[model samples]
Target: MIESKLISKALFSDKSVKSVNNLKDYAGIEYIASMNQTHSDLVTFVKSSAVYDSDGIYTEEPKLGLVVKTADCMPILLSDKKRIGAIHSGWRGLKSNILEKAIKKFDVNELSISIGPHAQSCCYEVKEDVKKYFNDYTELRDGMFFLNMSKVLKDLSEKEGFQVEVSSICTICNSSYNSYRENKTTARQFGVIWK
Candidate 1:
């Protein structure tokens, strides 16, 4: 079993939120806004606290937390102070530019993005075909390819002008978090933020 601690403070990239009972609570957030996460690029602006079928959620509404759940996939929290959003950025979601879609909902401005714990290149092996999707980020070792999922998000965030911070933990390598790729488990950790 993994040591489940209250969200590590040193591990946090921002001060927008904190983990609570495997469920992080964002400051000033009274309600929670999330998506069903279909691994698509679909991003929705939430009107209420209800969860819906989509990959991303954002809002300017105070006291409403924007959250996403992930095991191996990346949970990205975005905040520009004026608006906050969250996305379940699996490989499929990245390939489709879900972050880009999520940013569209907010007006043109700089943003802060944080990538929560997830599977990293050292533990996330992939097929050679995945290379075509990325320019020069994939690596080869003993004829097997390992994908740098974190880099993909960082690069994309840079291109979109969003300042980014990433968690150092790898879900697959560290038992503290769940990884469907490592154990095929359904357990997940939540990444939450608020505006």
Candidate 2:
């Protein structure tokens, strides 16, 4: 049994489909869309349920959902008056410039962003070699590297004129969400946004 309950528990009673029903029911939307997700910078502006080999997707169509699953990877939802996006960004995706790719499609003057739970710098330690891809976003402490992905993402989005809101919960620190770094499990927590 899943101890941590979601915002809409009734939609998740049958966990066989993860939380798709929760999103559909909570948002009152019908169509569900997603990507194959390769941890790359690929961002596609989609309109239907057609799956693509990308890490991010956005749409302006009503009653449609843009979904992505994550454990430790950051789930970013980009929104504006006319568009909505869901992104999957880990260190690799960030380094590949996924955020910029997703934001470029929308008008920043009307955009507002929400970053979902993920592994924060407080527990996300990395090797020194991986530090070369990021400079201002990472810190070297006690001969180890820690990444502030939320800040990096916030800074980047703000630079592009989007109002950003980051999640206070960390997947590694909060057992409510799944974390690969904590359990080496492929199980992921779903994050979705729709129009």
Candidate 3:
């Protein structure tokens, strides 16, 4: 199973030591070390480390859990109901098709996926250059470009034979949730998932 929570300082701190310990306690899953996320699309396959880091892709490992953290960015969860994966996918990661690549890594014919809260199109305005990266077939209007990342991932997952569930919450619009856009000068909330 996969579960996510907006971590608070009262629950844990940002420091590596505390974060790792807290994950173990809260989720009963060991801390597979966090990766140095550069927003790139490099996937890794982990087998034994309690904590593992990757830029994008991760294959099934023996670990009881995997975790990824996000603020305004998206947190993608993948699992076969046995092995689980967590990915931090922002605009850059999405363009790279990190989720698609991860799905390709598995040999199984089916899996379950979840796309967590993120900056939705309503608030995720971008520059023309960025918009140009999308195919012309995409729908666009009034100088605004909207990308349903969850739908995109769902479609991709279906193509690869995985069942997907999407959470219809926009972090920027939800004041209860932490958003980099809403609180530029404040601390960002951690989006953590583990199984």
Better of 1 and 2 by TM-score: 2
Q: How many clashes show up per model? A: 2, 0, 7
lDDT tens readout by residue for model 3, 88-119: 78778878878777776654455666666777
lDDT, candidate 2, 77-172, per-residue tens: 777778888899999988888888888888878877777778899888877666777778788888889988888877876677667777767889
Better of 1 and 2 by lDDT: 2
Clashing pairs in 2: none
Q: Give Cα-based local distance difference scores for all models.
A: 0.71, 0.75, 0.59
Q: TM-scores, in order shown?
A: 0.83, 0.87, 0.75
Better-scoring candidate (lDDT), 2 or 3: 2
Q: Clash pairs of candidate 3?
A: 32-50, 32-51, 32-52, 33-51, 33-52, 43-57, 44-57
Choose 1 or 3, whichever is better by TM-score. 1
TM-score of 1: 0.83
- Lowest summed lDDT across 10 adjacent residues in model 3 is found at 6-15
Tens-digit lDDT track of model 1 for 1-195: 111132222122222223432343324456777778789888887868887899898887877766687888888877764787788987788789887787777653566677888888888888756767865677888888888888976777667766778877888888777789988987677777754
Write down the lDDT that model 3 would get. 0.59
